[model samples]
Target: MIACPRTLFWIVLLVAACFLAGTTSGAASVPAPADGPGLTVVMDNNYPPFSFRDANGELVGISVDLWRLWEQQTGENVQITGLEWDDAIRRMEAGEFDVIDTVFYSEERGEIYDFTAPYTDVDAVIFFDADLPGISGLDSLDGFVVGANRGDSTVKELQEKGITVRKYPSYEAVVSAAKAGEIVVFILDKPGGVYYLHREGIQDRFHYSAPVIRGQLHRAVKKGDAALVTKIDEGFASIPKAAYDDLDRKWYGTPVAEPADLRLITFFAIVAVLIILLLVVLNHTLKQSVAMKTEELKQELDHRRRADEALNRATQKLGFLNAITFNDLQNAVFSLSGFLELEKSLPADEKTLAYRQKQAEILHQITAMLRFAKNYEDLGMKPPVWQNVSQTFLIAISHLDMAGLRRTITLDNLEIYADPLLERVFLTLAKNVLLHGKTATEISLSCKRTQEGLVLVFEDNGAGIPLAMKEKIFERRFEGKKGLGLFLAREILSITGITLTESGTEGQGARFVMLVPEGAYRFTDNS
Candidate 1:
């Protein structure tokens, strides 16, 4: 509740001198029974709805009406005086009034006044211009200039949070500054602020957050005035609950419905019906569109299925023909070998013998080329798979003579996405090491991770490749070699975007690095 006593005080003087009129002539005036004890009440006159001067130049509000009823219940002469909040507090402490209504209790005030039980709760909130972003409470007012009444408790609250605030004399002045575009952020009691905003037709220009501080409104008497406290509480308690509800309704409830309200209600009902109808039509149209699209997709899937079956049939036929051709060619080469062997036994001149030897060498190269082609025929025939690197390397070395060779594999349980012929790649590298790695004793396979990818390495303690031939070695034309092993290894790896490169010291060893791009490799275990 925004009703902090000392901090909320604000001066709004009435020039008409109508301050004492309510005590003598308004509904608050009560005939004094002879010798009856009396109580004088004071509160902020400028606080709207709770206490304020009406346009008729007379002080009237919930507080005023409440005290009038209190007089009837207690049979005591009650004097209700309205002044600026600060002035009311000053005069009450000066002993000019017996009670001050609409006050918030605080520790400092506890030493000066004895407060009655709280009668109502009010909320204090942060009100900001609608255009101001992120202004929810005191904490959010850091960069913006905030406005508050000169003595408002909210001002101190803002200041404590390290926010700067511009002080005004009263809430009225604060609202005026907002309307003038002088201040875009301010704090005020919600009810009074809302009432003023509506009256001025500026409610749309500002937005308010939920209560930043909730305070209970109470009436207070001089310290040590226990008798007066009891009288005030008892008088209020004696009033019927319905009476309090009526006052709340009069001040805060929905306005009384008029004849024009029925027409407004009718217009809103028609708009709501139209909106519902529009939604129903839109829903029906969307369902029809979805159904049409679903049918089109089903037809597309069926067409692809038929095309895939045809492709598979053609591939199987081609594979069978290729197998037959390869078997016939191998048989022809074997027969030629027998003929050459017989010819060797028949002595010939040196020149003729040299030509025969040359022919045999060409036959051997041709055989090696045919074997390579057979092996590569299935490359990329199937989708790439996640092969366990360590296991695959072991399988590759199994086909080689390893009587004296030692192998070290630190690839862990790493898996890489590559052509099924991935194992063939490792086999080719191992074979190269055995054939070309002069003086090599050990071969090792390992992997290291880099930003671009995982580098799968194969190295052997051998006469390593020369710097000039590192890349050229992967080319099929290298050394005019008939075996396409290295060249095909690169093709197999490239199927899944992996690259093979050699990066070994010339005299130290041979190192083959296969870079498995990111997303193509991962470890299966904690190695």
Candidate 2:
């Protein structure tokens, strides 16, 4: 049978009220127990779906609902205390709370608290600014600045795996920072990300990458609270599957994952034992068979060794090819820039200058394509080298046919650490506008430093993308036949820890905003 936690809380409150009323009548002048042993649950009030503040600023959510059920079924008072996420975690670790709600279990965390059977499945997702390209998976996030909620297991897991994690105080802060372009990627639980996107009204702008980090969400209690853990597990088991499903639907708009059945484990164990017995019986009759199997294993090991060698060689070759391609593109852009400069000096003839300008633009396109390809490949394998932001901008502009297009580029020239390869990111975007921005006669580029990091703007006077296409454009190969110019641009920018997103869809033309994190420009000693 399922016990509704919310209903139980109300029932308890009602009973307490009646008890106080009857006691006031001087029936028995006795005091209630002060501090008897009971369950203490710590929960964060700001986490929606899991837990959050209601209109009255009271803590409420699925966890709150479940705890009420525990109280009602056991007829015991489980004191629920609200605290901030960080404070709650610390208190739980210190054994101040007998139970902590909505914890994701990990091997490291298991050392601190005993975990209940998993009740939910969570997958980690990457959140970026609306204009940024969608990340395909963890590989796409290599070398990108990713934000995570501080004290979260997600942060711990990422850091432990050698992925850089920027810690924020709250999920709201993480989203705000990501939207403001302080971080290129924000890693979060899928459900949490969805809830946050809807709450922040940015659902149309941001998306989750297809690949996810899968994990189990389980309840946790103090390490020594074996009895409480067992009781909670029992409570969970007693709940009807339908009731659990309904609660999941209410919170996440999806059915909850069914608990894993132990039948498969039992079956596998039985199969393994039979196989072992068969092997033992055969061993006595076939001594020669063991030698033949050993030879086969040796051959298999040799083949694997060769495959590993081949893979290493392939990786090295790819890296070399990328480096060579980048250098070639750089030289080609320099040559084009020089030619354009010479065209301006020679003649004022309109037709001749126009031809030269067109040639320069074409060259610029080729240069951008090569650079974009190189950067895209590099992001998956190497960390970007930190360089001056101004330098990156200049490299990007070098690929622009500025003399022919007659566009002005302005900047505050603020110095910050940035990836040199990010030059391709801007070049590709500028080229995209020149090629497709039909209504645009002018393009403007500029940058500004904010309290957190930097914001780069690329605006064009061309007719903006249709309202419907604005969000879809960042999708990988979204236009089907269209090449991956914009997608590649987004990928490269992400590598340098910048998120590219579209802004002001209702305005005259398209405006792309790139939020660059401070980490993107940090200078290392070698640099």
Candidate 3:
């Protein structure tokens, strides 16, 4: 069981204060473009594979190696101070460190600090006694006691998801409780969790569950260190891909799994297809039945034909009058605007010219609205049909200028049952990139299989939608940009059963994910 809320507050403050006084207060100033005191970087002392004391008592890990590389790259010296996790946070607030390494991202922390993009991906896993079976995820923890490090995000996330968490002083304590059956399960970041299990020689006593949350590791820099932040970001971007892969090999001490190859992806994709309920509607007997019905209707229609001819004459006269009225009004407006411009060229009063200009602007707006209405009338009027994804994508891209933009598509084998307006969906998406994706260098379309179905991803390497606005961007009458494009695109896709969601990070890029459920998609194979 956890301590009461009030008791936990005092315990945390007391612990932070006790470590604060003993932790060395470094006097280094945050680095600048030139001539600075470098940086004081702090991290938890025992987070192995990130920062920890080796058997030789040498401080080494991914974070240490990165800082060393930064020093070599920029001629900037950095001081690494190791303290308890709680103490590191406290000292950072006291300005003892310019950067905090090995920090996880969260909204609350984001308020006080700026972070570099994730330097490493981290996974949170559930660990249980080895004898326990069927402990795969959070769902398996119900009706069982669980332990968490008192101040960990894993604890907060669990509690927020409505699980009861027994708080321990540290992660090591949580593992001990789980192994002793004091708690049925323990949750922690996988790398550190794996390390402690081995260090305690209890690796054989417990087993790990599938990852609970796949998160990232970021460096937390002071809020105002824009220059230093820029350098940090540049340094990370400069690091070779092989550097991280090699480090993974050294740290995990195993052959790490790479991203699935195309062949394997295709194999698993075939397996994951749950059902193939084609939406095509046809009845073999309907043609013959309709022919017989038409013969019978023909006899009856002879009598009705004369009455229909009379109604047609009346309808044609009314349509002619409507067309005449619309044309006359448009011609009159144009003539009036021409006369007003001619009057303005003469020595006319400024007020009179301004009034004429206002009238012209109103007429222009009316014309624009009329055009919009004309185009809007045909929407959703056509029957939905099977649209070839690659062909439609090619048509949409062909309409764009394609001057400086690059488009990549991998949807060759896919087709979806959607409204013929499906072409407009891709068109609108491309137009959005042109209008708003100022930084985008490329636009891409691709498909991948998920447990639910296939996802059609439209992505651009431009400024991404903020998390706050992910859903808001799709609202029909959102904060007032032309939201109609995406709104109509969503409606068109919905004529079948595809749903779209935006899942990109705020700064990474825009990713529009359209989930096409089981019955909506099929593959075209060339035999």
**What's every prediction's RMSD, in angstroms?**
29.1, 20.4, 22.1
Residues 1-527 of candidate 1: C-alpha lDDT, one tens digit per residue:
12222212121112111333343244434344454457778888767667887767677767777787787787888767887776777788899988888888777689899999987777898887664556666677676667786655566678889876788766677888777656667888876776666656688878999889888788999999899899888988898777776655444433345447766987999999999999998979876998889989985775455345434643664476478657856776776676677667777877557757766765775666567667767875665667788767755664465435666668767998777888899989999988889889888889899998999899999999999888778776523563368888987787677889899998899999888888778787553
Best candidate (score: lDDT)? 1
Q: Which is the better candidate, 1 or 3, if ranked by TM-score? A: 1
The C-alpha TM-scores of every prediction are 0.45, 0.45, 0.40
What's the lDDT for residue 20 in model 2? 35
The superposed Cα distance between candidate 2 and the true structure at residue 27, in angstroms, equals: 32
Clashes of 3: 0
What do the candidate models score in CA lDDT, each in turn? Answer: 0.73, 0.63, 0.67
For model 3, residues 1-527, the per-residue Cα lDDT tens digits are 00111222322332232122223111111222354577788987766557765555556665766676566566777788877677787888788789998888888788888888776677789987554556788876665556776656677778777776777766667666655435546888776776677656677777888789887777888787778788888876666666555444333333123335555876777766532322222444566678888888984664355335434543554465457547756775777777677676767678678667767765665565455345445444554566678777755654455445666668757988666778788998888888888898888899998899999999999988888878877765413446757866776676556898888876678999999988568897833
Tens digits of per-residue lDDT for model 2, 1-527: 22222322322332232233333323321122245577788877556556665555556566766766566566566677877678889888887778887777778888888988876555677776443553676666555567888878777667756776778877777877655535656887765566666656666656667536777667888777789789988876776576566554444332122224345666799999999999987876576777889999996775455445434544665676567667766776777777777676777788667758777775766656565464456543543444445445544554344322435455543444333446676677777777777667777777777876778788887777778777667764412335466666665565445687888454477888888776444333422
- Candidate 3 regions with alpha-carbon error over 4 angstroms: 1-36, 133-136, 139-143, 240-249, 252-527
Candidate 1, which segments miss by more than 4 Å at Cα?
1-37, 253-527
Q: What shift in Å separates residue 333 of candidate 3 from its native position after superposition?
A: 93
